[model samples]
Target chain A: MKSMASTSDKILDIAQSLIVAGGYNGFSYADIADAIGIRKASIHHHFPAKAELVAVLVDRYTKQAAAGLQSLREQAASPADQLQLYIDYWRSCIENASQPFCVCAMLASEMQMLPDEVALRVRTHFRNLAAWLTSVLRAGVEQGLFRLDKRPDEQAQMLMASVHGAMLSARALGDPGLFMAIVAPEIARLRDT
Target chain B: MKSMASTSDKILDIAQSLIVAGGYNGFSYADIADAIGIRKASIHHHFPAKAELVAVLVDRYTKQAAAGLQSLREQAASPADQLQLYIDYWRSCIENASQPFCVCAMLASEMQMLPDEVALRVRTHFRNLAAWLTSVLRAGVEQGLFRLDKRPDEQAQMLMASVHGAMLSARALGDPGLFMAIVAPEIARLRDT
Candidate 1:
């Protein structure tokens, strides 16, 4: 049972990296088989289909992200710190070349081409992220840690788009520094406001 | 000569939509042929290879965008108006579902999977765009139409990321209004500052 779980975990890991590097349609089961040194049939035994594989991967990713955000809420003393920590987390990821781009963001780019299940999961991830961001911004506004020209919901969505857009820009330009260059000002603007 | 040019144009148009719908690896000659009522052999004759085809498409898209931006510069009276026009252009695109997304922005999502020729063009599109944005912001600053916390270039990158990122968020959440919701505030902040 443990071995079976490990194989599934390995498949999900590879799928995520593949999805991040390219997109939903970018990689295939053959690519995963090659990376994992397993036969195509073994992967089928676990995932059964590509859409199902990615759907599961997105579900897991969404849960992981939700937990991370929840922990952020606990660990960060203020809403401003929460926002800073969130940006710093992605900053380090891009700088280190580890999980550089958000898998959901990459998948979102190919939203029209994704399977219904996979697409649905991607939407859920964004929805969840937006909600968490809204909460933080709302908290920040309530506590006087942040100022916004828009309502908290609107501000949260704007910040979310800026972060994801920065990721795409950094990846598109092949310059990791581009991420911070694009995002730091956004955080600074919020503080100055 | 005219007929051949039209066929090539049709092929490029179909390929653009397909790439926007999916990614670099999302479609093929067969898909284009099926869409255009032509043979795969014919698409091959026109494009020769997918990389060359998309590379050519990005080039055309860059030219078209540059022309549009140039027109915006001439038509709008000020940098603030230029920025407003830019946002309005994308706003209508999303609202009408005509040219709903930027082709280069979509290709940027699949950058790692793209061929060298195609990837190079995508990067060029971004650099050219960044330059145009920077110029607009610089003009705005000089004219006292806008205030920015960062340098013009940095603020330009931030705005570009926000626009592109808002597109992603709108598409991911299946809400087109989300585009304006996310971007209007960014623009408003610039003006308010």
Candidate 2:
């Protein structure tokens, strides 16, 4: 069971990195097989199909995001600071060239090409995160730490869009600092407004 | 000559749509052939290779963007208004489900997966648009129509990122209104800031 779990985990890790570097249609089990030095049939044994593999990947990514958000809630001092910390988290990821892009966000751009199950999971991840953001911002608004011009739900969408778009631009220019330059001002503007 | 030009033009139209619907890897000469009722050989006759096809598509897309920006410059009143016009342009595209996504921006996300020539063109497209945006914002600042918290170049990156990210979110949620809901406020805040 331990060995089986590690194999599946390794598959997911490689799959995610592939999706981040490319898109859904960009990689195959064969690619994964070559990466981890496993046979293609072995990947088929674990995932059975590409859709299943991507669905599982999206689910795992959502859980990871939830855990990160939970940690942010517990550790951060204020809502604005937490928001900055979130931006900073991506900033470091992108700057360090460790994991410069979001898997779900990257997959979301190719939404129409994704399988129904995988696409639904991607949407669910965004919806869940957007809802989480709305709640956080609402809390900030009630506490006088933030001035949200619209409902937290709408503002959350704006912030989410900004972060995702910043990722695209940063990647487009191959400039890590541009991500922070684009995101920090908007975040700072959120409080001022 | 006219017939050849139209054939390549049709090819560009289909290629851009396919790239927008998926990503760089989503479509092939076969897909383009089926869409246009032509043989893959004819596509190769025009493009020679997938990278060449996409290189032409990106160049055409950049030109279209330039024309749009020029029209906005001629028609719009203030620098802030020009920025809003830019948002309105994307909002309408997403809302009306016509050219809902920017091909260059979409391709930019999958930059690592694209050919060197194609990816270079995508990066060039972004750099050109960012420069255009920086100039507009700088003019706005000089005119006192807008207050920028960062350099115009950085702010332009921010605005460009926000727009691209918003497109991804709008597509992810399958909601067009969210595009405007996400973008209008940010543009509004940009002027106020």
Candidate 3:
């Protein structure tokens, strides 16, 4: 029974990887079963349907990402540092190939194709990240650690868009260094006197 | 014979619209044929396969986009004006709903699912746009119209990435105004001494 539980976990991990590489329609349970050396029936037993599988994946990814952001927030001395830490984390991810593609980014690209539940989850993820970022920027401004002429929410949206755009550029150019190049100045522009 | 040409052109036009709304795999020949008041067999007769249809679409989009950019270059009095003209064109597209989504933006989102030829064409579009923007930035710097701390190529990439990123954000947020808000400041920043 324990082994079966491990197998289910394995299936979810593989599915996330495939989904990040492609979009929702890019793979199927049969592909997951083949990749994991499990029977098609076994995948059905675990996930039941594609929508359910992606919903769970989005849920898991959002939770994990939120926790990660929380940890970053706790570790940084200031909101500016927190923002740097966030961008730096993504830079490392790109440089080390730890996560060649961001899960949220991949899902955002396929927003039109995703089920409503899955799309809602993806939308929630964006809102959560942007809100966290807005708070961080607001704190930075209050503490005189950052400068911005626009509202925190607008700046946060711009920053988020730039980050996602950098990911697409990196993927298109096949060079991770470009990611840092695209993001560094945006971060630098936030430094306050 | 002319009517036959018009029918084929109509299919391509509808196909582009559907593909923009959805991704590459979002629609079918039947959908295009139905929208065009034709038979599925007619679509098949024009393109024979989805891959071929998309390939042709990508090619035509790239060519037309390049021509549009060239026209912007020819009509503008300066490089700065040219860049603003480019942004203004996209802004109008977003505002008037002429083209709410860029073909390359849609294709970039589906790169993982696209065939090699289609993917190459998409990449080429990015490369061409980046190269043109770089040349414009370089000219602006020389003409004392713009100031930048980075190489023209890098800055151009940043600008292009920001534009694409803004599109994703605007689409996800269901607010076309957000697109202008994200990009206008970036353009203003470049014009700032």
Which lDDT tens digits does candidate 3 get at residues B1-193? Answer: 4445577778889988887777777789989988978899988998988988888888899899999999988999999899999999889988886777788777776676688878888888889999999999999999889998689999998898899888877777667898899998887888746
**2 or 3: which has the higher TM-score?**
2
State the local distance difference test value for candidate 3: 0.84
Q: What range of 10 consecutive residues in model 1 chain A has the weakest lDDT sum?
A: A184-193
Point out where model 1 deviates above 4 Å: A1-5, B1-5
Candidate 2 Cα outliers beyond 4 Å, as residue runs: A1-5, B1-5
lDDT for residue A191 in candidate 2, whole number 0-100: 87
Interface RMSD, every prediction, one decimal place: 0.8, 0.9, 1.7
**Model 3 chain A: lowest-lDDT 10 consecutive positions:** A1-10
What is the C-alpha lDDT profile of model 1 across A23-116, one tens digit per residue? 8778889999999999999999999999999999999999999999999999999988998999999999999989999999999988988999
Question: Mind giving the per-residue lDDT tens digits that candidate 3 earns over A42-149?
Answer: 998988888888889889889998999999889889998898899888899878866767786677766766788888888888889989999999999999888997
Model 3, A31: alpha-carbon shift in Å?
A: 1.3
What tens digits encode model 1's per-residue C-alpha lDDT throughout B85-167? Answer: 99999999988887778999998988887899999999999999999999999998898888887889888999999999999
Clashes of each: 0, 1, 0
Task: Evaluate all candidate structures by whole-model CA lDDT and list the values in order.
Answer: 0.91, 0.88, 0.84
Best by TM-score: 1
Relative to the unseen true structure, what is the C-alpha lDDT of residue A139 in candidate 2, on a scale of 0 to 100?
81
lDDT tens per residue, model 2, B1-193? 4445598999999998999999889999999999999999999999998889999888888888888898887888888888888888888888888889999888999998888888998999899889889999998989988887788888888778778888899899998887877777767776855
